[model samples]
Target: MPPRPRTSRRTRRSARAYAILLPAVAATVALAGCASTVSLEHAEDAAAVECADVVVRLPDVVAEQAERQTDAQGTGAWGDPAAVLLRCGVPTPGPTEDRCVTVDGVDWVIDESDAPRYRFTTYGRTPAVEVVVDNEIVSGTTAITDLANAVSVIPADGACTTVTDPADVTP
Candidate 1:
């Protein structure tokens, strides 16, 4: 065979540079394809302390939704599509006519006005814990039940009552 053509210095340098950059570019693309990061607004200092327990005790999975990374101080998200989202240290809601359910000793006010999605907020807690789940994707009961343990960290000061008259019920 005839003598092989020698590669010029510039050509060799270009090949070396490309070889070094290929892996980095591939890694960046791979990371970008993963579940997007979620960031929530920070809560007040007082609520932040009250939320620490629940945040730390949150389960890795809820209603079959795997936990994902969150940048918020007191928030968590589960599933690639985010079937469940939790925010702690939220403002405590006052008495309302909304339906309430108690799970594992933790009272939750259920809001289903938005069909296919349900919002459950802890009742009577100083700094309430809020959990939003897509009913279409996961069972609302299961998701709330899974979070009961973490929410229990906040003590219950009161609960929902069915008394229609003050005189009919004894304090």
Candidate 2:
């Protein structure tokens, strides 16, 4: 019986061909049109910015506000000054159609200038809670917009205005 010679190169070439061909076939199969569904995870959370106690600092320094007692008037209207007063723990002053309600000497009003609508002034300090998905009530200046993302009411535009004014629109 004669012994057959072992062809080393032939074996090597076939193995290499198989390695290349296998991946091509797999890739085509993966690309073939097919219906499939995938589920994705999402994350959500409320705004965590602090809204109280901290001192408010504004640039383009206004000498008037620095006087401790800033008389914010003509802010157009308080979304519902009455409601804002209630949120600030102000007692009922009297009957009124304006968005503002009276409490003692100073009238309480709602300021919705910044995003995530919020109260500009409180009993003594300004409320600093970041109103997420609401108006951007940054610092004290409120921007005019109709984004509908306002968390409170429409803010009075231009110049200084008090939310206590009945003309102001309250949420």
Candidate 3:
């Protein structure tokens, strides 16, 4: 019988390394395909450490929608189509004519200019948190309520209030 050539140690090691790595790479790619990342723009103060605190505390599931991975810092998205999107470290909202509601001790200024999709921002918290919810997909109330605890990580410096004008009163 003819003698066969022996495989070199380096070639055998390379084959072994590939054999071990191929499956891992395939599995990782498969898993990555399963979970789609939601692209989002970072807030102005997204780099702030306080934003990290809020992001870490975000709920896994919000308004019956599961949380998805976001590309930006201090941002969170829930729902496959992303019915709810949250951005922390946004500019603090100034007093406006917009309606404000307090949920779970957190005051949120509601902007209804865009119907079916409302923008709710923390009323008094500096580096305010902004939550945009699509009413058709999920309840804005539920989304805001679910996010209250996490958003409350930033202490409230002020609160939503109604200014009474004396001129409106009839003598």
Candidate models: Cα lDDT each: 0.86, 0.28, 0.93
Give the per-residue lDDT digits (tens) of candidate 2, residues 120-144: 3322212211211123222223211
lDDT of 1 at 75: 90
Task: Indicate the TM-score of model 3.
Answer: 0.81
Stretches of model 1 off by over 4 angstroms after superposition: 1-33, 43-47, 163-171
Report how far off residue 74 is in candidate 3 (Å).
Answer: 0.4
**Candidate 1 per-residue C-alpha lDDT over 1-171 given as tens digits, one digit per residue, 9 for 90 to 100:** 999999999999999999999999999889867878876676553356778888889999998888888888889888878889998887887888889889989999988999799999899997888899999899999999998998898889989766376678778
TM-score per candidate: 0.74, 0.17, 0.81
Please provide, for model 3 over 1-171, each residue's C-alpha lDDT reduced to its tens digit, 9 standing for 90 to 100.
999999999999999999999999999889878988999999999988889999989999999999999999999999989999999989999988889889999999999889899999999998899999999999999999999999989989999898779898888
Task: Give the distance in Å from residue 50's predicted Cα in candidate 2 to where it truly belongs.
Answer: 78
Question: Positional deviation of 103 in candidate 2, in angstroms?
Answer: 85
Global CA lDDT computed for model 2: 0.28
Clash pairs, candidate 3, are none
